[model samples]
Target: MSKTTPKYLLLSLPTSVVPSHHADDALEAISTTVSAENGSAAPFSIPEFKIGTLDALVQQADELAKLESQCQGVVAKVADALRNILDGDEAQIERMMVVNDKPVDQYLRTFQWNKVKYRADKSLAELIDLLHKEGASIDNDIRFKYSQYNQVKNTLATLQRKQTGNLSTKSLASIVDPRTVVQDSEYIETHLIAVPNSQEKEFLKNYETVAPMVVPRSASLVASDNEFTLYAVTTFKKHSVEFVHKARENKWIPRDFKYVEGGKEEERKEVERVGGDERKVWGETLRLGRTAWSEAVMVWIHVLVLRVFVETVLRYGLPLDFVSALVRTPSSKQADKAKKNLDDKYSYLAGNAFGRDKKGRVQRDDPQDMHGAGEGSAEYTPYVFYEFEFN
Candidate 1:
C-alpha cells in the first residue's frame, strides 16, 4: 500500500514529520487521529500497544511539556528586566519581583498599588497649602502693625495738641520781658521798669503757660503751617531765640505761601475747575506751587502718561492682581516702567480725554514715540510707549 501522509502530528514531533497546516486545525486533527488509534479517544486514554510505540508517545508528551516550561521561563526573565528599569528604589524592585512570580491579573493589581504609593509620597499639594497659610499670616501681621502705628501716632498728636497752645502771636511783648528802665536825673523822675529778673526766666514762664493752647501739636520734625509756629517755639528754645528770630526775618515767602490765604486766586480757581472739590484742588495747587512751573507741567504730563498705561493693560484682559505681581520687584526698571504706565493710563481715563468705545470697552490711544540721541551717537532709536486701556 502507498504510505498515507499523516494530516497532523504532535507539536513535539520534528517539523519534517508534521504536515504543513494551520497549528490550531492540526492540533484538533491530531487529537481525533490519536483517539481512533487508541481504544478510547479521550485525552487521558492510552492504547494497549507494543512497548516501542508507547515509549514514543510518552517521549512526545515530555518534550511538549518542556517546551511550554521554557516559554514561561523566558517571559519571567523579560518581566524581571522591565521591573528593574521601572522601579526607582529597592523596595519597589522587590515588590515588582514578587508580583512577577504571581499570575498576570495579580501583577496588574500590584502595579496600581505602587503607582498610588509613589504619588502620595511626593505630592506638592501640601506645600501649596502651607504657602497659603504663611501668606495669610504675613498679611494679617502687616495690617495689625499698620493699625497699631496709626493709633499710636493719633494718640501722640492728641496729647501734643492738648499740651501746646497757639504759638503764633502778633504781640512779641507777650513773650518777651520789658527792658529795665534807669532813673538818673537832676530832679526826681519816675520811669517804667521790668521786674528784677532775667528775660529768659520771663520767657520760660510764658512758654509753660502758652504751650497748652498750641493747636494741632504733634511730634513730627517738620510741621504744616498750622503746626509750624508751634514747633518754632520748641526750636527757638532749643537753639538761640535770636537765631530763630533772624531765620524767620530772612524767610522769603515759599511759593506755597502764595496760595495759602490771599495769594493767586486764579491758580486756585483753575485747580478747582480741573478737580471737582475745592479742598482737593487746593492741595494739588499747593503741591504744584512748591515746584517750578516747568516741573509742575512735567508732573501733569506724568499723570497723563500713567493714565494711558492703566487703561491699555485693563483692555488686554491682564488681571490687576497679576499686574501688581509683575511690578512687585523693587529695583527692576521694567517693573518701574510698568507702574508708571499704569498710573498714566489711570490718569488719562480719570481726566476724560479718552472714553469707552461703542461696546463700552476702554479704547487705548496710540502712545507718543520717544527717542534718545547723544553727542557721540547721532543715530536715534524709536522707544516703545508702554500704555494700557482703562474702563
Candidate 2:
C-alpha cells in the first residue's frame, strides 16, 4: 500500500449472527480480515470515496462489535460464574443480578483469574485457553475506544435529532432556544432549571426572596413532572453563578441542558481519535462480488447495518431502541418499504434474534431480562433486529 492509502477491511461475515454449537466454530472467521488477504488493492475501491473517514470508523466499530458478539458466550459464562460466586448460589436469582459497573468489575477480576488458573485436563485447559484468547479481545483498550466511539456517535445523533425536531420530550418541552432566551435584554441569561417537585410552590413563593431578591417575577415555570418543575430563570450573566448557587440552596438541580456545549461531544472527539485495530474493515458486504457499492448506499447501509450490528452484538447490554433511531430511511410509505427490506434481508438469522413486533414492545421471553448484561445467566439473544419506527 502507498503511504497515502488508508486502512480498510473486506468483511463478508453473515449479516446476522449464527449460533456456533461449539465455541471454536466461528473463531476462524473472526480472525480473518480482508486487509489481510490482498494488501495492495483497496477494499472495494469506492468511487472517489467521499465519506472515507466516517465509513472507516463505522467499519472499525462494526468489526469490534462483531468480535464482542462472538465473544459474548464466553463473556456471559464468566460473568455468571462470578456473579454466582459473589451473590452465593442460595440467593434469589433476581437479587443476584449484576447490572452495572461495580459487579462487572468483579466478573472481570474473576474471569482474569480463571484465565491464569492451572488446569490438568486437556479439554478443560483448552476451553480455558479459548476463553482467555477471547477475553483478550475485550480488554480495556477495545472497551475504551468502543465506548468513546459510541459516545461520539450518540452525540452526533442527539444533534441530528434536535435538528430534525426529534429531541426528547423533556428537552423539547422545557428547553427554550438560547437565542430566544436572550430576547431584547443582552445582559440576562436564561437557564432551564429544574426544582424539586416538592419545592414547586416554595420556589414560586420564595425563590426571589431567598436568592437575594430580583424582579421580572422570579422565574417562569416552563414544564413540570412528578419529580421536577422546569423553570426559565433569568439573571445578569455576571451574577449567574451566584444565582445558580442561590437556586440550589432552594432545591434546584443543576442540569446543563445545552447539548451542544455539554462537553460530551468534545470529550467524545478527543477520545475517538485514539483509533484501534478493529476498525480496519470497511464494509461487511464490500468484498469481491460487492465491488459495485456506491457512496450513498454505503452511508445508509452504515447506519442500518450498525443499528442491526450493535443491536445484536450488544443486545443484552444496549437500550432496546438501540441505534434504530439513527437508521435514515425514507419519510413516508417508503419508510415501511425500507423497513421490510431490512427485515427480509436478515430473515435467515431470525431464530436466535430478539426483535420488536409490529407493536413497540420488545419481544422477549422475560421482560426483566431487558435490564441487560448483569440481569442473569442469560445468553445474548442474537440477531436483535428492531423495526425502524420511533415512539
Candidate 3:
C-alpha cells in the first residue's frame, strides 16, 4: 500500500438493500459515492456465526468488540516489533504476512475469513473464549522470544565493542602477550599500566623507583592504542599495592590484570560462543515474530466478524439478514467522506435505538451512553462499522 492509502474498512448493512450475490450494487455505490476515485470496495465473507438468545448476545457483543480491538492493537504492536528486529525496514513486515504466495495488498483485497480455525458451529461464548486464549498465547510467545533475543544481542554487542575499543576501555586478555607476563612467581608480580604517550619516557625512566622490592629494568611495552600505551611492570607481591599508589601519583593509570596460562585462547572461545548464541536466538525470534503476526491477524479478523454478527442481531432485532463488506479508501480524507456518505444512505437503519451528535456522528441511545460507556459501547457506529489498518 502507498503511504497515503489506508487499509480496508469492515462494514455491515441490512440485506434489504444489498442482497446475496448482488453485492455489486453496494460495491458500486461505495466505490463511486463512498470512496470516490480514491479507493475500492470488495465483499468480505463472514461465516454464519452461531447466535444465542438476545440477552446473551447483548453481553457478548460488548466482550467481542473489546477483544477485536485488543487483537487489532496486538497486530500493530507485533508489526512494530518485527520491524525493529529487521532494523526498521517496513517492507520486511509485509513480506512476513504473505498469504498463498500473494503480496499483502493483493491478499487483503481478496481476503477470505478463515472458518476452519474458528468454527461457526461453536456458540458465541465458545468463540470468544477461543479468541482470548489465542491472543494471550501469541502475546506470551512473542514476549519470551523478544526478551531472549534482546539479552543475547546485548551481550554480543558488549563483547564486540571490547574488541574494537581503546586499550584503556578494552579487554586486556587478548592484548597481553603470555610470554612477557611473569606468571606463578613467589614474590615477583606483573602489573599492567596505561601510560599516556607523552609520559612514556618518564614512566620508563622511574619505573624501578616507584616502590621497594621492585624488579629492576622489568618495565616493557606491551600494546599501544590511539589514546594510551600499555606497559607491564614487575614488583614484589607484598609491595604491589604501594607500587600502584605511587604509579597513580605520577598520573599513570594501573589496570588490574591476572595472568593465566592459555588466557588468550579462553577469551577467543568465549567471544565465539556468545556470537554463535546471538545468531541462533536472533533467527528463532524472527521466526516466532512472523508466525505470531500471522496468527494474531487471523484471530483479530475472527473477532471482528463475531462483533458484526452480534451487533446485527441486537440492532436488527431478530432473524439474521445483513450484508457485510470490506471497503478500502486511499486516504483519511476519502475515509471521512466515505463515512459521511454511508451515514447519509443508512441513517434510517438506526431506527429508535441510536441518535446523532451535534456533528452528526452516530451515537447510541442506550443507558450505557448516559453513564460513560466502556470501549465496546463507545465504539458503536451507525450501520455496524469498524476500521483497521495493515502494518
**TM-scores vs. true structure, each candidate:** 0.16, 0.29, 0.78
Cα lDDT over the full model 2:
0.39
Ranked by TM-score from best down, the candidates are 3, 2, 1
Which stretch of 10 consecutive residues in model 3 shows the poorest summed lDDT?
Answer: 367-376
Q: Model 2, clash count?
A: 6
What ranges in model 3 sit over 4 Å off? Answer: 17-24, 178-222, 231-256, 351-380
Question: Which is the leading candidate under TM-score?
Answer: 3
Q: What would the per-residue lDDT of candidate 3 be over residues 202-281, giving only the tens digit for each residue?
A: 88889898789888988888999778999998898999999999999998989867767787788778789999998898
Model 2, poorest ten-residue lDDT window?
A: 41-50
* Candidate 1 lDDT, 265-376, residue by residue in tens: 4434543444343334333332322221222122222222222222223232232211110111112343334333333333232324234567855443432221111112
Tell me, by lDDT, which candidate is best: 3
Report the error of model 3 at residue 104, Å: 3.2
Candidate 1 lDDT for residue 386? 24
Tell me the spans in candidate 2 whose CA falls farther than 4 Å from its real position.
Answer: 1-180, 183-185, 216-218, 254-391
lDDT of 3: 0.76
What is the overall TM-score of model 2 with all chains considered together? 0.29
Span of 10 residues, lowest total lDDT, candidate 1: 40-49
Instruction: Count clashes in each candidate, considering only residues at least 3 apart in sequence or on different chains.
Output: 29, 6, 0
> What TM-score does model 1 achieve against the real structure?
0.16
- Per-residue lDDT for 77 in model 3? 71
